[model samples]
Target chain A: MAGGGNLVVTVSPHIKSPETTGSIMRLVLLGLLPATLWACVLFGISGIAVIAISVITALFCEVTWHNLRDGKGTGRTWFALVSSLVVPIGVSAAGLGRAAPAAAIALMSAFILSEAGISRQGERRHSFDGSAAVTGLLLALVLPPLVPWWIPFVGAFIAIWLGKEIFGGLGYNVFNPALVARAILVLSWPAHLTAGWFRSLGIDATSKATPLMLAKTGAAADLTAYYAPLLLNNPGGCIGEVSAFLLLVGGAMLLWKRVITWEIPVTYLGAMAVASVLMGVDPVFHLLAGGAVLGAVFMATDYVTSPVSSRGKIVFGIMCGAITMLLRVYSKAPEGVTSAILFMNMVTPLIDRSTMPRPFGVVRAGRGVRK
Target chain B: MRVRLIDLTRGLVQENPLLRLMIGLCSALAVSVKVENTIFMGLAVIFVLTLSNIVISAIRPVTPDNIRIPIFLVVVSSFVTIVDLVLKAYFPEVYARLGVWIPLIVVNCIILGRAEAFAYRNGILASTLDGLGMGAGYTLVLIVMGIVRELLGTGSITMMGVTLISLGTGFQAPTFMITFPGAFLTFGLIMGALNKAQSALAERAARRATGSAGRPTPVGGV
Candidate 1:
């Protein structure tokens, strides 16, 4: 070594935490599983299909982007990319029934080859960690379960490539990748994204407006009837957002595990409750509806996008709640959680800068410590 | 003549008005939604730009330094007015689609920027070439953007009621590609791609300069 091992010239924050990104991501995934399983149970095979497609596509994009960026073995990378995509496209174009089987085989083979490639001594890590999976699952959770097979595939691409990778990959992204994908999907295909909800498990399980949508037009569901449904199942909203009780349970698990701090979620829900009441609406219903619980417990507390300071987290959470309520009450859109978290994500840097804690024993430069 | 050719070709790539110079973007963003609109808009800009450059260059000696901006504006406005009137009279449909932008071209920074930077001191020939080159570069970007936005946003490209290419009925076009944010996104992506290509070209040139052995062991190439 140039300066010997003792004189290690490394970057700042000399101490290190035991938690690797992989470990933390694993915990995060574990936390999200309850709500995700509930979502699958509620939305059925179509829901599981959406989740699988999104996760697979997300993992694909993550690896593909990394390989392309590395600039070595680019020919092989391009071949892999084209071959994986062409098989499906070609299959469809040749009047073969469904491209799904071809796509699955091609993608699985690509993943296996990539896994072997990364297992070598010095290859890029590329989706070895579970962050991409978490993003994919989060995006799937936000999407309505009944969208065409292609929707989640496209969304996973957007979430990974546009939302995360384009912003210098995971840690530097300003917004939650899942939320960005969901919001863009909504904006791009309102007819599909808005109307694909599978609500209230029964005869007419799909195509009905969400309770929040109906409430916007002044036909509030019976409070007691909705209370149990919204908490347990079949609140007729986004896939993972159907069971507020399950989401809450997951949120509590994450909090208890100390994976996420209480500042953002607590303040967010508290503020939402207060604001909803002020606006003459039921806070409990508002909290259960749309993406409120999912966003507060998961999206807003994102380690990279959210503020570092506890005070900043509180401020961010309150602003998110206030904006969520304001958008729900005033804006044309029935759901506000996605936009609220996204908007606050943009403001996170300012919150962090302003909320920096003063160093111990330090006084203002203009004033003396004695004074 | 060689220098003059360089001046003529430079703006078409290296010193492109919209991408490189980054001047006159508002009009481009506004009018680059349809392939036909871009064509008409591009033509109008080239006409106004070249004539204004010629006029400004011709009058450069007489024009006072104290109020050069105002002089440039007057010269630019006269040319823009001609375009405005001509388009409104002949291509009324394009004029309507490009509404406020035609008038807005008078205030476009590219004209004044070139007048101040290049045309104010250059010969009429050089200024004329620069103007044409810059205008062509701008139009190229506009056409590319129009094709991209229209093709993606609508699943097809149509120019003057003639369909060029359609992605068929199954294609679910993302409407985001047609919106204002889409304009910024497209512009950014194009710029990023150009940067990537330019860097690659520079790297190849460096490799050639280093020697035909092609090992590229010079500096950090290894």
Candidate 2:
């Protein structure tokens, strides 16, 4: 009777039981399902195989490393493994069948090793967090399917180790781990990673060039051709990256679940659209091409690495979109989303610091510096 | 003899240029991609370090303190030029591979660091021993890093155009290892491990000296 009369209240900096890491990771996985299913429908068994191999390898590496280092059996390892493995497979499967096996194996191995190695040395192995796997998957998806497998591995390693762990794991990292992996991979293996594109579900996939690639190389192919396949299931790039429609569906689910906010995706897409129009390029082609939609929706809006405040998120999104277009149009590389995300990741700290919410009835300390 | 021995031993651990002082990292990271390059770099460093130390020590008293840096550079450059010529003439392939890095030996902080810190203050013989010891330590680290990077990146160990060992066809070289970022990653991890090892060794030594049970000591501390 006395317990029934008791009242409990929670305030700001409140420990409201929101979504757990596992739950958020699960949602991200769920969000990816549409794109993954689409990839399967297009690419066939080989897509499934690459995804399976990447996921199994990532899970095995994480669990084994955890068990060996921690000296105790934690059942939570399975959850982490599942989350990490699924993301990469979904992403990679989006543009599978074009990449070489050796390259894939090497890249994935490097990625897993880097994540595991770095986590082992630090406080509490966050390798089981599913973040690294998501990073690897997203990176693999954006890369041209014909790339050496080793490129993803290297990218994964850089993303997890340098991008995440170096700044202190998971929540501490300022940049999106997936973008970090993709950026490093693109920089290191530019030739293989950006060589060609593949068609989703096509029987005889060949060296197909993405619209962005054609634009960069001055190919006179009509822009409509690129836009048409992108709207459907064109496999000229990473697995989850090919179909703009699938990406939008998955992204919409994430937005609806509040897994990610609309600020980043909206501003990023908006900026890119404006930039594309200004550049005299078709805005729709830019939006549907490369890793723009995947990056803006999934990679750029990562909860841990992105800004907290609504305003900060907007700034982050604008910068990501602007830098992406700049890199795509001006830079030598065909895809700019990875670099854009990484570059914005580097600036996220400053964005957060400047954009912190003001106190009640109090003037903000450096109003001039406020964006 | 004891003083010279002490000087020699100092570079091995107490002030190991690579591990403790953290000097001469450019060549260490850059040329340590291959075992052969590592060996060549190590020998070149030893030659440059030893000769510069001896020459600098001999002229220390006559040299002005203000112009010491420039004078040190000149001496280091002269020795590096000689090494560069020798490598180019005899080990043409190594020279070709090492490229600008061989000339860059003059700028290697290890040689100049020893010249300014130890050689400029010590006797010729003592400086010579110190240089050799420091050179050996630097060489050891370079070789270890080289072996690690080469073995992982390429999955094989080759020396002077000879494949000494192969890890079979499955061993595919991570091409990243041949790039700049790979060098940084290898150097960083190796440095971290070396830092851990040095702290562990110091703790053991401190316990032995004090006749007490050794506890783990923090790195970069005595």
Candidate 3:
């Protein structure tokens, strides 16, 4: 106001989009609902229980942290109160005994309260938006059904705090929070993450090797058993990732909603199929097994962590697929979807930078100079 | 006397050599994997820092300005050698674990930086207090990092053939906490916490001084 002198401005296309982060996040959650419901039905109450605990913990942590940091109350306190009431039911549903989940919740609550002392206003417009819930659900989907329920609680905390908050939350994160949490959990407790795949529900459900694990050992009979089950979501693998058909349906919804473009999912699966065939592995099995479908459609397409342009997205996909196939075939781990997407997440900015489109009606400086 | 007391207390928090000044980080990050190793490392740093500061400050008047760096190095290296040999003789296991780090302390920036910045200009008493303060601060950080890394990485704390705590047999410790990247992450988080606490304290002090009638604000509080 003191020195109002020149008022020079430029540029014409100044229309703003109507979409807010909360709205987009809501769409993502809606798109994920189909596959999530299928996973719950297939895995039974235990599956729903896993998802419920994760979503509740994530929302509670986000709201509590934001409230304490900014000294303001959140609407989601009601949600936390409700979650606390349901903790017993959820724990019982998941077949976990009284001690572990309770202990984890107690520890997590203490940690959140302590951290809230230094909490500044976080980057999100509101705390209880659907992003944290989306992250929670995605992380749970990638986990084995019989994993200690506390693993989800711990993973949600780490995913929200270390992965998102420390990086200034939501839009600023470099890696997908769910993938980051899963990667850390996998590295930290390899035994729990890789083992304990439940084949079904109730007394009939058995702890069996995942199809990817059996395929890793080159067992033809085991591979044959995987043919229909892998696609139909009847196999013993990570909770939500076994349902390739359902995931595809969910991915189609995301594409129809315009929440995600087809560039990433198509290129990723295409590259994966080509690579798997070249590596002498069954392409269909590679596409359907492990977390490949879940990650390529859901994780790799994360707007905050993936490239912005279509070209960059394609490159990001190819790189993700190539590294995933490489790790699956050559590395000791039977699945590499999480690490591959996380690895590509780290490179998204670089791809975007290199693939930035030139402005319209602008002459190249070097050419102009020559002329 | 008051000023000298401040010098002694400053390094404990205000000018912490590890978290605040961020000097000698190589040793802090590398050797803070075990509580036992941290204890040995801390003791070694204290012995070397205090003695080196005394020797440097006592000789500062007679020492030529043109070659103060060489004189400082000589003093530091002498103390480091004594620590090295004494550890090798008495605590061979720790000595072996510490290995090159014992000798590497001679080049630690905290030692050389203090000699040039504080000891070279200050009196012997002030220099000695600064060294003690800095050494205490460094030791405190090393011990804290050691505890965090050891507990999380191994699921238990064992020192000098004794177990202080254990997470039981069923607990699967995150081995990443003891790795190199884990060290960096731990150090960064600790540093951020220290910064936040210091700033918060400063802000409270400022608020009090501004609100009240006759209180003097803390020196360099902001």
Candidate 4:
């Protein structure tokens, strides 16, 4: 069972299995579920709302851009996209109920056009194909739980459009779309993105900095007591930063399923740990604070953006961790997981090119395998 | 004096210096954060460009080909200095905001490019019009970018020390739009939208052409 993609042809030594992009993406969603569920449980209704808006917007953007780019008879669909985008920019906290109808109509029409088979001759239906879903969910996971409704909507648009589609969609995207969106959001509306951190089970929200931020204050002797709460419960950061334990569990599941390799996660965390010691910060605190675990496990190991060869993956991870530590120690920004991962994403191509393994039976430059 | 309309109109859209020709972008991007800065910058560029074009065209007959680039620089820089002095004297606020970009206009590709490409071969009248048109095109794009960036970046458009448009007190403008990367994003999106529109127009024209030819098209059978 080589999955549903039976007709795919490769260069040579085609190893076929029951794995498609959909299946891998499915595995990724499962991997992320633990942290996401924990985040939702911690943040409550606001967290669920943020996730819903982001995922729906992500789907809307994916479907809208896909149909506009590839679908036939797309005049009406084009109108739908413009109206949906224009209408939502006005969606404030007091006006969510008003924007709901417009969003619903636009989404429903797009869903019908894509799924209900208004197929025009040779035009094939575009699948939702969990890739966009993963990006949306990952974007939600990285967002602060107490964000305004429009923040996730805008983030998802940026993720799908500027981050992914503009780079020629999916595997062709150079950076992880979720991280790209998060970085831009952090830059665009720093006040909105940085503030509004919620606590678990409806405790005090807003103005509470993440553990990474607190570490910047240098409570050198008082840090150890916070590790237990930071590990299992939420302190104050992005939604997914709630439980390092659950995120690690999900990461381990992915590792066991071979969805993600050990090189990136292991090297990324290890490098951060070692570098933290070098920088005179507590290594365990560095490892556990902010998005280090989530970023190392999920963001850095993105298949499209990460390097291919084993050596390249190691280089990528080590550099990511090093950059994260450097930014955390010296930079004005509290955490640097997003920036570090994006920086490594930009460097991934160079790493892949440098570390590409030679063909079988080929010794050095002078020796020939065929001869 | 041969005055061709194409010489004046072409730069407006068909060959916008910033968007289509992709020249004079350094100053364009750098000074495009606010609407007022763009207006003054556009004026400075237009004044220098027109005068430089006229001078370069007038000197073309006597100016030797080998030394013409140096000659162009001299003429362009002379005009740029005039603009710099005038802005410094009259519009100190805009000048202070524009800062180094005003002086940097001496090396602006639009002015030098018009001198070398159009004015050197054309008459003064044509060169003058070309310069104005190109400058207008540059101004148009700069203003559009300025308005977009300023409106989104600051949540309002303030011109001439007066508030023109405000998004309201609740609006938290994205500070990113005023940053360096935002200029690039605005430029790219504008260009992309223009490209998409042009492609759509071309496609429709092709479809119309086929339909008018009365051939039994593929769609006709379907």
- Which candidate number maximizes DockQ? 1
> What is the fraction of true interface contacts found in candidate 4?
0.73
lDDT of 1 by residue, B1-222 (tens): 235688789888788888888889998887888889999889988998899898988998899999999989988999889999999999898889889999999889888888899899898999999899988999999999999999998899987788999999868899988888778878888887787687777768877887755654332110
TM-score versus the correct structure, for each prediction: 0.91, 0.79, 0.80, 0.87
Question: How does candidate 4 score on lDDT?
Answer: 0.85
Q: Enumerate clash totals for all models, in the order shown.
A: 0, 24, 0, 0
Q: Is candidate 1 or candidate 2 better by DockQ?
A: 1
The ten-residue window of minimal lDDT in model 4 chain A covers A199-208
Tens digit per residue, CA lDDT, model 1, A1-371: 77666767878898999988888888888888998888888788878888888887788778778878886557866776677666666667778735664475457456635654654568554446788889999998998888877778789888998899987887999889999898888878989898887855663322487878877987665644566677878557788777888888888988988999999999999999999999998888888888888999988999999999999999999999999999999999998999999999999999999999889988866787663
Error of 3 at B95 (Å): 2.8
Chain A: TM-score in each model: 0.90, 0.75, 0.82, 0.88
Give the candidates in order of TM-score, highest first. Answer: 1, 4, 3, 2
Find the 10 residues in a row with the least total lDDT in model 3 chain B. B213-222
- DockQ, per model, reads 0.71, 0.29, 0.55, 0.67
Cα lDDT, model 1, residue B40: 89
Quality of candidate 2's docking, in CAPRI categories? acceptable
Residue pairs whose backbone atoms clash in candidate 3:
none
Better of 2 and 3 by TM-score: 3
Error of 3 at B127 (Å): 4.2
Candidate 1 clashing pairs, residues 3+ apart or interchain:
none
Please give the TM-score that candidate 1 achieves against the real structure. Answer: 0.91
* Model 3 spans with C-alpha error above 4 angstroms: A1-18, A73-127, A201-207, A220-227, A277-280, A361-368, B1-7, B52-78, B106-109, B112-127, B166-173, B212-222
Instruction: Place model 3 in a CAPRI quality band.
Output: medium
For residues A1-371, write the lDDT of model 2, one tens digit per residue: 44675675546876567777877877887777787777766665545544544453444454444453465444544444455545545455676534444334544455545445645446544346665456556655665554544455445556556666655466888777666656556555566666645665552223576667776787835776666677777646677776788888888998898899899999999999999888887788889987888888888888877888999999999988888888888887777887788788788889999999987878655764566
